[model samples]
Target chain A: MSEAALLHNSLMLGAILFAVGMVGMVVRRNMIVMFLCAEMMLQGVSVSLVAWGRFHNDFGGQMLVIFILTVAACEAGLGLALFVVLFHRSGNLDITYWQELREENQAAFMDREVPEEDREKTIWPQLTPSGVEPAANPEEELHRSRV
Target chain B: MLTANEHLIGSAVVAALGLWLMLPPSGERLRALGLVVAASGLGWLMSRMPGLGTWAADAAFWSLAAATSAAAVATVVSRNPVYSALWFALSLLGTAGVFALQGAQFLAVATIVVYAGAIVVTFLFVLMLAQPDGTAYYDRVGWGRVTSLLACACPAVIVGVLAMMLSSSLAGFEAGTATVAELAANVRHEEHVARLGGTLFTDHLVAVELAGTLLLVALVGAVAITAQDRQKTDARKTHGGGASR
Candidate 1:
């Protein structure tokens, strides 16, 4: 049980944690899961930071962790804000729904009945390239096409 | 070679056991067992060293920090945002321990208050508000992750190289030195608040004030961006409703 042994343990733990996070990030399909993976990665770095700080008897690493926490707070705030916006604009939280929101992209076969309320909030009408008159009830036109 | 720090050996063993219980129970159990055994051995060795109580304490702090960080990673990668946020808070607490070991008691407490208490609470708040759907999220963005990883690789390599060089240099200087102990003792004897205040005022005065101002501005911006006009939106969902609208 020497200093080297302690360090080796720290390194091993850090590596395993990092690998788990990476695998989760890669394999997970949910946005929330992806966020979790990113958090795991952040945790890995924090562990390394504390280990390095102790190994060298420096406070700089501690200070850096503080900064990282602040950045994480800000990131979570903005990310959730964006997620809310995406969810509201689209009926579903699925990423596939997001492609319709992407600028300059036309959905190949998304013709579906849109409720009047949904039509007001929808962005697809504005993106349509054809000169055809705007449907009196675009929701109905969308609904009819989908059927 | 028994030392004053021998008392810490017990706590170290307990901590190692806690870690073992925290890990996965499958193939990873062997690795966790190995870590616990190694930690126990390391604690025993530390007890045999003379005048190494502070070093032992510091090592313990680092071990806790690393464990917390690893836990955070596991949480994040679990595809459960709530779990990730939980690990993130644990990591913050571990950082507080590291700060305490570095003899910055105020900073340590502050780190916990700001990160574990405030920031993590906010993270949970956001998670609940966002209600991020997980099942179909990957179908959309999975292809782009590899590109992002490649983009991050160069910086990671550079950071890795820099850290190795720094660690080697510091190890060389600290190998057989008594100077650090004297310095640590002197700093402790002088009230930390006074020294830190004097240094901050005399040398880093502008930076300190700027940081304060920046924090204030950020606080205001967050409130403004998240705030909703009562006339425009329902009270129950003020923060997230605007984006959806």
Candidate 2:
């Protein structure tokens, strides 16, 4: 393809990716989802840089993208580790669990009303009770559920 | 001609409406409608890209770009975190294809390896530990009302403004053709990854070293942050017989 055509395509794709990521970052409540959105934004920028570099007829864009990959790897490692710690504290990945960390004067966010779900009985995979079904002790059953 | 201002504006509007509807806490009916609208909007935008260069490359670009954008939307909107992670991987692969099309062979492979191999696994491991039996409650819900209104509009604005900027940016520039020696003086004449690496080592070696150091620091930081009093778990292990605790 001609450089002009490629530039147009790459820039447009990058824009869409960045925009979608911004929306996801703002609206999604799960911390992992939020992190994924951030990475998506990075991908958008990388696409644009590559397009410019290609248009200019050099590998400069690729070089920058390599660095982006490095930083992203670091971000992934530390971010996921922190996520584990946060999950231990909140018992779930919901960002709302950390609302208390918001600026002291800011009012707590009122959650939007979710339309009621049908609450269908989801069929979860269960092992055939192989040993002392539910393990005699109720507390043991609780521990088993954690896995 | 395909990506004229009016066409871009129309696409941005349609996509914005779709995204607004898709954000959670809305009824499932609206989310379905949103999916159709958003897909069409993105499809129209992709069609606007002029693909006259060659048949085969155009075909690949069209298919890869479409898959990448669709997967991107799915990654954001899927209520199940596991499904989201899967969708994100598909998107990553599609992006890698785009990179390859643009002639960044090394970056493409690096993207697939570092992202599909590492980041997604970490996300899944975290999700496996944190998820309940089904979709979590928060995954089914979006942000509050005021936040939603503002957030949902951001993509449309960005797409529209970016479209205008791209058109303008193309006006004053021409593609440069660099000879091998021009790009990498020290390396032997070759194409693809060889040239990429030659440029890296000759010109940007310092940045590469710094990146390595950053990776090391981040590794140590992750380990330190996740470290805990091992004796606590050890003590529990002894008391509980350690079989399945």
Candidate 3:
């Protein structure tokens, strides 16, 4: 195959892999699965980058793939740590279990009952409107108070 | 348009349908059928594409692509997290193969070592620690298969169309007329790793430094988060007064 054809084929494969990752991210509820899918997407992008570099006769794309590898490693580490912590708090890795972080007015999607022990671990702070309203006229309020 | 372009569109549609079938929440019987269908569809699509220069190279590319996509599908559809991780390793390996085929031997090796070796090990460790049992509730159900399929299809179609368009437009360019063997020879003749090193140290030094710093920060953050979680658990143990569970 010609270089352009190779590049085109690789690009198409990368795009397809990326789409698969997107679908996986959307469908899977497991945090680990979601993280893996994201990595897959990165892999797809990396493929295209290398292909482009080869096509253009430049090493830039290869260098960028290296950086992508570094970032992916870091992301995986942090993501796994977060998953561990979330699992500890909730006793499960179901992403839906952490819906308390969603906007206040939105109805909660987490229908599963949390164990009493786990519930104590998850201390979701109540959002309350609390600060005192500023006076319409601070000087007038001060004078009126003095009077 | 050209016959090749028409085939590409047809292949994309078939592959999309295959993917739609392979997503989870299906019955065991249907899932098996979906796997076969998806695999065949992808394989057929790949075979239909214009061959790379040498028959051997083309075969290698097709096999690697098939393996990568198949393993990826398995990774998402597997009910067991361990199996998913293993499948992900296979997928990563296939991706590395694709990388090597693209003249990125260094990146391919790095991907194998970093992802398959380190990252996958870490994930497996977490999986074992978090869920000692076989399966979890979230693994089996709760996936909005149809909705996710629809969402994924939109981007797939758009990307396919765009790639086709770009390739078609660039068809007249003579810059990429080199055959696969010549391309391979060019890549082989160059000291890619040394050149990459030079590029890193000269052109992308700051970015390299930033990436290093980012890795350091991420490591520290991960350690801190895990440590804090441990402390919290210890505190709860003390507060609860003798294993409340």
Best by lDDT: 2
Q: What is the TM-score, restricted to chain A, for candidate 3?
A: 0.70
Model 2 chain B poorest ten-residue lDDT run? B180-189
Please tell me how candidate 1 rates in CAPRI terms. Answer: incorrect
Worst 10 residues of 1 chain B by lDDT: B18-27
Candidate 2 C-alpha lDDT tens digits along A35-134: 9999999998899998888766667788999999999999999999889878865678888767667677998775455433336633467978666544
lDDT by residue for model 1 (A1-147), tens: 133333333443454345445655544444555555565566556656655554554444545554565566566556555555554555443444543454466545552432112233324545647687765876788768654
Tens digits of per-residue lDDT, candidate 3, A1-147, equal 467767878887888788788878887878888898899889889888988888866778888899999999999999999998998778888787776777869876664543122345337789898999776987787769654
Task: Compose the digit string of candidate 3's lDDT tens values, residues B1-245.
Answer: 54766666666666666666666556577777777777776766676656677888888888898889888878877878889889999999999999888778888999999999999999999999898895676676645565657865775586568556755756653465555455555554367677667778999999999999999999999999999988877888878755422
* Off by more than 4 A, model 1: A1-76, A91-147, B1-59, B62-66, B132-171, B175-178, B185-190, B223-245
Ordered from best to worst DockQ, the candidate numbers read 2, 3, 1
Quote the positional error of residue B118 for candidate 3 in Å.
0.6
lDDT of model number 3: 0.78
lDDT of 1 by residue, B61-88 (tens): 4577455645543453333456667776
My TM-score estimates for the predictions, one after another, are 0.52, 0.81, 0.83
Predictions in order: lDDT: 0.50, 0.80, 0.78
Over 4 Å off, model 3: A103-147, B1-6, B173-188, B241-245
Q: State the weakest 10-residue window (summed lDDT) of model 1 chain A.
A: A113-122
